[model samples]
Target: MQVNLRFFASLREALGAQRQLELPEGATVAQARQTLIDLGDPYASVLAADRAVRAALNQQVCEGGAILSHGDELAFFPPVTGG
Candidate 1:
């Protein structure tokens, strides 16, 4: 299955604004992240399991366990804080 990926904030600076990704059927958000990390370098560092990252599915906040479907949009960004 193919899904759209959006990166925001620092993640955007690191991985670009957005890109299309191909994932196995039934892949979860966490798995998609892991796939990116598996590519090594910046991805492995930026999206590392030790780091804090937030995700959204189809513009709605979602958990790592969220199942992804074809044409779904997934976004990753650093936690936000406002004064």
Candidate 2:
């Protein structure tokens, strides 16, 4: 299945660019992230355990275990902060 993966704000810089990913059936958001980590250093560094990373699957917030299908749009971003 093909999914559109977008990284925003700090994540964009960290990931280098937004990319289209072809993943296996039922891939989860966490699985996609792990693939990014395996890509190399910057991704691993950015996604390292910090607890603030956020992900939205199909425009809805979802746990890492959420199942995904073809044509899904998964987005990753830093926590929203406003004052």
Candidate 1 deviant stretches above 4 angstroms: none
Q: In model 1, what is the error at residue 60, expressed in angstroms?
A: 0.6
Supply every candidate's count of residue pairs whose N, Cα or C atoms clash at under 3 angstroms: 0, 0
lDDT of each: 0.96, 0.84
Q: Estimate TM-scores for all models.
A: 0.96, 0.85
Residue-level lDDT of model 2, residues 1-83, one tens digit each, is 99988888988887755788888998888898887777778878887666478999988988788888899998988989899
Clashing pairs in 1: none
Model 2 vs truth, CA RMSD: 1.6
Looking at model 2, report the run of 10 residues with the lowest lDDT sum. Answer: 43-52
